[model samples]
Target: MDCEILENTVLLAIVTLISVVQNIFFAFKVENESKIANSKSSQKTSSPAFDKVYTANQNCTDAYPTFLALLWCAGIFCSQGPAAFAGIMYLCVRQKYFVGYLGENTQITPGYIFGKRVVLFLFLMSMAGILNYYIGVFFGSDVKMYIKAVSNTVSPFLLIP
Candidate 1:
């Protein structure tokens, strides 16, 4: 395999590793927080911290499928290296968002803002990949060659690195 392909694979592997570890941490935090809340009260209402943890976990769980699908779609169709880099950034920012949500203030944090931006970027990249393929199919263009041509024209100006 080409060096670039190997490097992209490594980047993706690192992202996956970090994401798994982060998710495990989040799960532990949520469970710990829940336990603390339960110890305090048997009422339907949980503690504020517990509520925040639950919300954060729920939001992540809701978005997980969509996020992973878009991530892989962009990685395969767009530039894999950049896609993987974006994935790393997304994971990092998402962790911050999760942690920040557990704080006393529930207002949107910097992490939340940056995470949304990263998600928007990933969405656009995934759309570009999918759209490129469909456009090729409809226009009877050489899909791979045409995508390469278009990507070459656009990538030089991108500040991906």
Candidate 2:
């Protein structure tokens, strides 16, 4: 696999790991606050902290499929470099959203908006790439040539350590 794609995949894994860790940590916090030893029973308690953590984790879980689809689609169809950068930004914003939600729900807006924009950008990239591919296939427009041209024009600016 391409290094950029691999990097993006790793970023996706990291995002999952972060969510899992946060869930576990907050679960413990809720357990401690409620003095509930049983995980299942603890979930039934009506506590603000538990609700925040549950909602935060649940929000991430709900959006995960869409994020995964967008990440892979954009990484595979579009330029991996841009996809990877977007993935990193998405991860950062998600962390912000998670932490912010734990503090105050209102604080999550910036991260939520930024994350949605990143996903939208990935969707656009995926659409452009897929369109380019189909156009090339049916019209003999030479997708590789265009890709090469674009890569040459954009490569210098994308270089990273």
Q: Which tens-of-lDDT digit does each residue in 1-161 have in candidate 2?
A: 78865764665456556645755765665556455434447456556766776677778768877887887777667666666667667777777897899887688998898888888877876786788889888997857446535633543442221
Please give each candidate's TM-score.
Answer: 0.73, 0.69
Scored by lDDT, model 2 comes in at 0.69
Candidate 1 lDDT for residue 85: 68
What Cα-based lDDT does every candidate model obtain?
A: 0.72, 0.69
Model 2 Cα displacement at 113 (Å)?
0.3
Which 10 consecutive residues of model 1 have the lowest summed lDDT?
152-161
In Å, residue 35's CA in model 2 sits off its true spot by 6.7
Off by over 4 Å in 2: 1-44, 143-161
Clashes of each: 0, 0
Model 2 residue 89 CA deviation (Å) reads 0.7
Those runs of model 1 whose alpha carbons end farther than 4 Å from true positions after fitting are: 1-10, 42-45, 135-161
Error of 2 at 20 (Å): 7.3
Best by TM-score: 1
